[model samples]
Target: MGEENKIILHGTWASLFSKRVELALKVKGIPYEYVEEDLSNKSPLLLKYNPIHKKVPVLVHNGKPVSESLVILEYIDETWKIGSLILPEDPHERAGVRFWANFIDQHVLLSVAKIWKSTGEEQEKAQEEVLEKMRILEEGMKSTNLEICANDLGLLQILLLTTFGSFKAYEEVLGVKVLVQENTPLLYSCVTSLNELPVVKEICPPHDKLVALLNIYRQNAFKSTTN
Candidate 1:
């Protein structure tokens, strides 16, 4: 690869979206420079690359930039054909994967955010929303006929395992169990299997680190809302 062809990933370790891109890159065994950004002080290159959203997990390939974790994942899979494919070959199956990935991001993750960011009746309502969304996801995934163990690491698997893999963080931070085995059995089983993969095993930060990160994140969210 030429100097200009070098690949770089600008991201923050605290950002789940950044972790998603990192997971895809590691799973593919792709070599790239990882530039960790302080969300409070984003770099000039990141802003130049992603002027619109100006967020981390911005992929810089051959001097060109690609923003958004999902788009970056697809780009990586298409650009590099090595390792396990992130999306299925079958068109229908591929569509299902994409749909569920989006659902997890838009629906499931939003409800989870509500849990940490609110309290009292609102937080309780958010907890209910989390279970309801997960229930719908569990049933919808049944039609895909996927086994409880995720042998193949597709887009949906990447999103779920990386996001919900921090299941304990939700429980610890909220003081109430939200993503438990009894509530989301299929997800629990699949995340366990996914964690066994060599490319991505035990990827979550330590418990103390996780708790500290959650506290910092919650504080930032509160600041943003109050501002």
Candidate 2:
């Protein structure tokens, strides 16, 4: 393929999965057009390309579509070998990184999503699960303190940033309140550590915005049940 046949990404700005792909491309110095998507009414192109998951962070290289954020990251790393590499060169190290990445998606992302979407007792239960999961992440970070891999960010740091970003949304959209020192101190510490990093500080979302968003969701959820 020629220079004009470069990759194109379809995703949403608020989506962590989409953010992952964007960060991977930015780290690799890969230039590609970005198409913001509305998952509520997905674009025909998105449905056509990623018919399986039909999710964002779909990468099209030379018109070939690759869905799933992690899969797309691997594609970007393999296709463009310049700048920072996503996976480690060592096979064992690479496996470790992959393991955490998957863990973030399954354990953190999954639980946090429920925190935002559920309400009443359901929401409370989900919050309990989130606190437990955050504890697990906090322990992992304390134990390994994984070395910075690419772009001065470690595997745990990336997971923390992405997972916290999602939690910020939950705290913003749902009335289920969370205080750093009160509810989940370890998770709060995790967020503080990740925020201290220069690169992460630039990429992550603001706390105020998350809180404001959560207020709106809470009001809406209240109205839905009451009225």
Candidate 3:
């Protein structure tokens, strides 16, 4: 690919969405530039490029900007057909994979955010809601015997890593063991499977890194509260 058609990704290193996009690009063996953005002080280029969400994981193709991590993933897959595939080829399998990805994004990721950010009785309520959602997710996983992609990592595994990885910071913020083999058997199993895969094992962030970032995030949140 020429520089004129060069791909550039704007994202933060710690963002799950950003990480997913990065992994997709790396799997496709696409050469791209990475721009780390600070959400608090977002770049004018980022704002102009992704005026809709103004979010990270913005993939700039040539001069065209494509926002949304999932969309970028599809684009990367289509643009470069190298290495293992991210999505399944069969139509039914693709739908099933997307279903799981959407489910985790809507339920687990959203619920985790609420559970970690709230306080007092509100926090308790959020935690209860998260547990209910997790139960539902676990039940759903129990019924599925999905096949892995050529990459050895599928949508379900990606979603699982995203959801369970969020809880890696629980000890730092909630001061509790939120996600473990004992606490969340299904999720823990999925995470463990993903970890065994070379691609996922190398790509996923370490729990300690997330914990440190969460501590910083929590400290900043408290300062904002007291201010």
Best by TM-score: 1
- Evaluation by TM-score, superior candidate among 2 and 3: 3
Candidate 2: regions farther than 4 A off: 1-5, 119-122, 148-151, 154-156, 166-169, 177-190, 193-227
Q: Tens-digit lDDT track for model 3 on 1-227?
A: 69777898999978888888877776666788889899999999999999988898899999899888878777776776787677878887788778777777888778777755667787778777777777777666566656532235555655566556556567567754456565567676666566566666666677788778878887776566668
Over 32-102, each residue of candidate 2 has an lDDT whose tens digit, in order, gives 88898988899999999999888898999888999987788787777777876677788877887787777
Top lDDT hit = 1
Candidate 1, residues 1-227, lDDT tens digits: the string is 56866999999876789889988888888888989898688788888999999888899999889999999999999999999899888888888888888898899988888877777898889899999899889888887874435676778888887887777776787776677688778887888777767766535556678888888777777677678
Candidates in order: C-alpha RMSD to true structure? 1.8, 4.0, 3.0
- The TM-score of candidate 2 is 0.75
Task: Judge candidate 3 at residue 120 and give its lDDT.
Answer: 79
Cα lDDT of candidate 1 equals 0.82
TM-scores, each model vs. reference = 0.92, 0.75, 0.83
Model 3 root-mean-square deviation: 3.0
In TM-score terms, candidate 1 sits at 0.92
The collision pairs in model 3 are: none
